[model samples]
Target: MLWGCFSSAGTGKLVRIEGKMDGAKYREIIEENLMQSAKDLRLGRRFIFQQDNDPKHTARATKEWFGLKNVNVLKWPSQSPDLNPIENLWQDLKIAVHRRSPSNLTELHLFCQEEWTNLSISRCAKLVETYPKRLAAFNGKPGDLIVINRLAYHHWAIYIGENEVVHLDPEGGDSSSSLELLSFRGEVKRQKLTDLVANDSYQVKNLLDQRYRARDHYVIVKEASSMVGRQLSYNDDTYNSQHFARDLRYGEAESRQVRRAACPAWAGLAAARAATNDFSDRRLLYRSLKRLSK
Candidate 1:
């Protein structure tokens, strides 16, 4: 889950986000962000949200939570992320988040807040410029593409059947898979039906389904249409629409070039970029693209 705030000398600030892990709605926080952004606008001035179509963000509940305001949520492409700019910034933020080594939520919050304030504007702009690369990554393999993390709860895994592998998952115990890796975490390795079972290094077979608690744990990257697409639409009414549109263009381009395209993060970058575009702020745009291509 991620939250983004856009600020400018003219409009003050606006807040937006992708959502939370459990998918819980945070109206108070959302409103707080809006109110923060609203600080800059004149009492009657209008600002946009550039919201995505995540259903969670656009549901009647969200509208009710936001209530009536001078704010307008923009319409954006349904599943495009390759072009959204903020996605790129969020990636850096996540990397920074992962690197922070916070002991608890309070520490994490403080670190995150500082990071947010210190974020460079040049990096934000490059996120928009790197659309070509994003489109390239998604040009193929567009369906049911699992992120396939290697480190389960930051550890290794086990083996079970032919073509099946297992893991000690974060949710709790062990899990195995014949079609794909266990739900826990592991790098994607193409092993033959015989070889997967034969690997000597791994502990072969957990047998108990109940033992594998983390087997059900999955970090959803895309939705039925595409996580990227939904994020593109999210906050289109704010400032991420252009980023989403840019992602849509990349997705379309990749589809044309290869026939498939996946990689939801690219769309997140598109959203970030759109936010920057919204206020005509070039803060992080330049640097973001450089980091993305690398």
Candidate 2:
């Protein structure tokens, strides 16, 4: 067996594993090669170490080794195949080493090392550059609520899988300026999550799941997908980004931001009752009452 890693910086140390591999031997390989590889690749402090959830990789000793080194290991998803860019390099290395036709173990090791080094830095960078799309690919199951934090406020969407989301994009499409998101007319649009997120940070946040039961995943996805390309006049008090996502996930449209800004403190319980009773269509009436009471 063999072990290796790569980054936008370049390929890391490649080690040939002998005999049956276990936790101790796996830790030994990482201890011997990981730090040196990081230094050689010029990856400064704060680089996240990613590895599969193999039994040996997640063993107690391995966890201790990382803790001792203060390495920030990425929490890999269970049952998910490793999608690190190094997988692509492995394929290329196999083809190149095969052409040499090594006859012995010693020759095979030598050819593997040579081919690993021959992998181009540009190719490594391109892989890393396009990695985000793949990173978001399995983040959420279908119909899961996803949130993008745009500094001032959060943009909400429902994951329909394949790195795409069902979201309400402003009529002119998303704007680079965060302020523009405060108020705008929008339409339900199916867009790539990466394209919608741009440089902003996002995560799968199935918020309020404890308070409100999530609808059937297939039903949520089907209903949300059906709204694609439908126009919506943006109204924080009635229907907004968060409301749309919540409606799909929970069969109720409730925006905490809108309630806090537009509703009175005395009306909190009443507002909750309204949401539970499916009085969403009467939100405009409630908003007018809030204004009058204030």
Q: Report the C-alpha displacement of residue 1, candidate 2, in angstroms.
A: 1.0
Sequence-dependent TM-score of model 2: 0.48
Off by over 4 Å in 1: 7-24, 38-44, 64-67, 79-83, 125-186, 189-294
Candidate 1: minimum summed lDDT over ten consecutive residues — where? 145-154
RMSDs, each prediction? 19.8, 15.5
Model 1 lDDT, full chain set? 0.38
Q: Which prediction has the highest TM-score against the true structure?
A: 2
Report the number of the highest-lDDT candidate.
Answer: 2
lDDT of 2 at 262: 58
In order, candidate lDDTs are 0.38, 0.74
TM-score of each: 0.38, 0.48
Q: Please give the lDDT score at residue 147 for candidate 1.
A: 18
Q: After superposition, how far is residue 244 of candidate 1 from its true place, in Å?
A: 29
